[model samples]
Target chain A: MKRRTEVVLAGLGGQGLILIGKILGEAAAIYEGKNSVQTQSYGVASRGGFSKSEVVISSEEIAYPEVLDPDVVLTLSQQAYDLYKNKVRKDCWLIYDSDTITGEGVSDKEFGFPITTVAVELRNTRILNMIALGILVKLTGIVSVESILRSLEKNIPSQFRDVNLRAFQRGLEMS
Target chain B: MHDRIKFLQGNEACVEGALTAGASFYAGYPITPSSEIAELASIRLPAVGGVFIQMEDEIASMAALVGASMAGAKAFTATSGPGFSLMQENIGLAIMTEAPCVIINVQRSGPSTGLATKPAQADVMQARWGTHGDHAIIVLSPASVQECYELMIQAFNFAEEFRTPVIFLSDEIVGHMREKVILRDDIPIVNRKFPKVDPPEYRPYQPGEDGVPPLAYFGSDYIFHASSSMHDETGYPNNVPDNAEKVIKRLYKKIYDHRDEIIITKEYETEDAEIILVSFGASARSAREAVYILRESGYKAGLLQLNTLWPFPDEKVRQLADRAKFMVVPEMNLGQIISEVKRVVEARIPVYGVNKVNGEIITPYEILGKIKEVF
Candidate 1:
């Protein structure tokens, strides 16, 4: 298993990119007892603006908070995909929402899922981030499923917990 | 033990530290990259029977802090660039009146609201000399979320111990970044000393052996005046040349006399290092990584992370300069602290600055590239 992993979740503002990044960081830092740092950047607009959250999880202390080179890049919009697609290294895992992005010039490490469609089928489009998170855990095993579940219980409100958990479970199954 | 570990943004951690330090009053106008401090304070202060007020502007907010601190409350305010600019006048008031308070400047890019949400370290000089007149101030900067929590307690402690306004100089990147913070139950808390004299005999500005006058809170039995003018020992205006010099010199003396206690710094891998990277706030994190990469690449690079920015840590920098052949200072500003490093090194070693002002953090690789170019 990798001792350190850098993950970037990029999408339009209001897509819950930052929240998922927080969940991932909490899982590693709080639940799994590893070190982690989560830093985010977004455009001025409240919604539909460029948003990116980077999480670095490590067994040791993390020196730089921002992601220099990502081990995994997850894009939820075509704009996000376009921005980060060429920036990732050749061996990096590139995950995207197939429902919204076209997977042109695919690589073996690239994976696309109908993340929005799956969330809609789960009866809430808001859970797309959780589905993407599920795919990330299944692919990289950076953080355990149990750790993420415990982290969700702490981060998500009681009213939204059930839907989010179901979305995450479905995500684990899809990949 | 697991329950004590939590993930928190640097801004949130600062609020927790302030509350833990017994800060019972907060008044500020919310500003970007720093609103979390106010938001959390609003929720937490009232619950702890503390006071939280959203003043009309930064000027009023700073006034409220000084007023509250004088009234015996450990008070603080959080703001960004423009708001910090507005508070400069009252910061001087806090200084002149000898009211201990913490002013949190979670700095953003700015000449004037330059990039409202972006991080910058351009306020180093401003934190030192923004207010008019020559004055000594305590300015502490933190590079991580955990330090945000820990240093905030130190900020409040120094404010009370020195009886002056202490600036908690944080930048947007450090303020917004989330990381694990251990909520230690054993952190020490410091409170200002109170007057032991009778009400009639009490003189508010009369110094004890330590040069710090025991503060008398408002509504206390001590009926002494506290004014912003050049006051004598009784806290009444005495603008005589000798009296003014005495009053101002005491203010500087109270801080500088105990300079060793007020300044804190951290050295990483500098025992035999020839190349030293000096930095603070978020940029220090990058410098730390740059040191690691350089060491792995067979270069003797180390880091000197300044936890306290003001009073400039001249002696420590000078000591490090004796052993170092080259020094590099990395900052989010074009070049603020690098000048301080240069002044201390005094051309004993070649000093270089890797400055960034594009609202992006100075990455470790960028610092490494600069080291390679100069090495």
Candidate 2:
């Protein structure tokens, strides 16, 4: 197993990219029995501007929280897909929202899931992030699916916990 | 002794370290990436019968800490970026007054609020020359969460030992990252020696052979004054030529005498490398990986990581310069530590730069590509 795993999640603000990174990092550290450091970079503008969170999980201690080049890149926007596609290594797996980012450059071999479309069908746009999270867990297997679900249970606010859990389950099934 | 290795952010570790070092007072404004330090101190300090005050700004934060230190209590404050800039005026005053206090500057991207919550090590030069004049300051840059815990105690110790303000220069990444930090019970700690004599004989600026003047507490039996301006031996402001010389010389000598005990650095795989990447903070992490990757691909590369930024560790750097053919510096800033590297290299070696200012960590691939290009 690789000692270090770097994952970058990029999308517009309010897409829950940072939350997803946080969930994944916490799951790795708290559940998977590893060490992880999650750091984020968000823009000034809300909604449409780029927001990225880089999570580095390792069996050993992590010195630097910033990810240089990610081994895994998850894109939820056209801009994010374009931004990360140019930098991610060929061997690096890319998980993207098939509905927003069209067929073309990196997504040819990439895992494409229409997360937003799934959320729309479920009549909840907010859970698109959980959909993305499920796909990420299934794809990478960095943490057990059960652990991620438990992590979501602990992390999500009490007010919207039920919907988020359903969204996570739907995501896990879709992947 | 084996139980306290709990998961903690760098800021929390700093609080723990300060507590271990017997810090009784903390005063600071809340700033992102570093707010946790102040928050932790607030919760932890009062529990230990210590005082934690949230000041209006960083200037007041520094002032309060210095005042608390002079009141015969260990003191500290933590801030990032613009707040650090705000604290510079008092930082110089702390130096002038020979105040023994610790200031933790958890660095974020800046000049001013460049990125409120992101990580960057752009404050290297600011930690060194943020103040106006030529005064020696001990600044320790910790790269890991564990080091953040350990260096905070060292920051307090160094500040007390030399009766100078010490800056625990750290970055947002290290400051915010959570890791397992061992909080040991029996860690060695030091406190500044205070005056034990009759109050009338005490002069706050009177130097002993080691260049450290015995400190006096406010509200104690000792009646003395401290000035930011040049002061005579008796703690009175004087424009006399000899008095000015004595003050400056004593100030410099206090830190200069302790330089040997102050300097620290970490060298990685330099025995057979041709090009050495000199870096600190997060950049050093990437540089170490870059060296590993380059070596795996059959290239001779190494890294020289500096944990103690100021007093710049010129001798260790000079030794590295003697061995490596080319030196490369990668920083989130435009150029800060690069100039320091150049100074020690003295143009004897070809020094290259892989600079980034778009608020991103310089990666191993980016650094390795540069190493390849330069080599």
Candidate with maximal DockQ: 1
Q: Residue B159 deviation, candidate 1, in Å? A: 0.5
lDDT of 2: 0.84
Task: Kindly report which residue stretches of model 1 are placed more than 4 angstroms away from their true locations once superposed.
Answer: A1-3, B1-3
Residue-level lDDT of model 2, residues A1-175, one tens digit each, is 5568889889899888877777887778777888887776776566778888788889986654677657888899889888888887776879889999964555344788988889999899988888888888887787899778777777789999888888888888887
TM-score of each prediction: 0.98, 0.87
Among residues 3 or more apart in sequence or in different chains, the pairs in candidate 2 whose N, CA or C atoms overlap within 3 Å are none
Error of 1 at B250 (Å): 1.0
Instruction: For model 2, state the Cα shift of residue B53 in Å.
Output: 3.0
Stretch of 10 with least lDDT, candidate 2 chain B: B1-10
Best of the candidates, TM-score: 1
Task: Give the alpha carbon lDDT tens digit for every residue of A54-171 in model 1.
Answer: 9999989889888888899999999888988778888889999999999764445899999988888878887889999999999888899999999999999999998989988999
Tens digit of lDDT per residue, candidate 1, span B219-324?
8787778887788998899989999888788888888888798889999999999999999999999999899889888998899999999888999999999999
A-chain TM-score per prediction? 0.95, 0.93
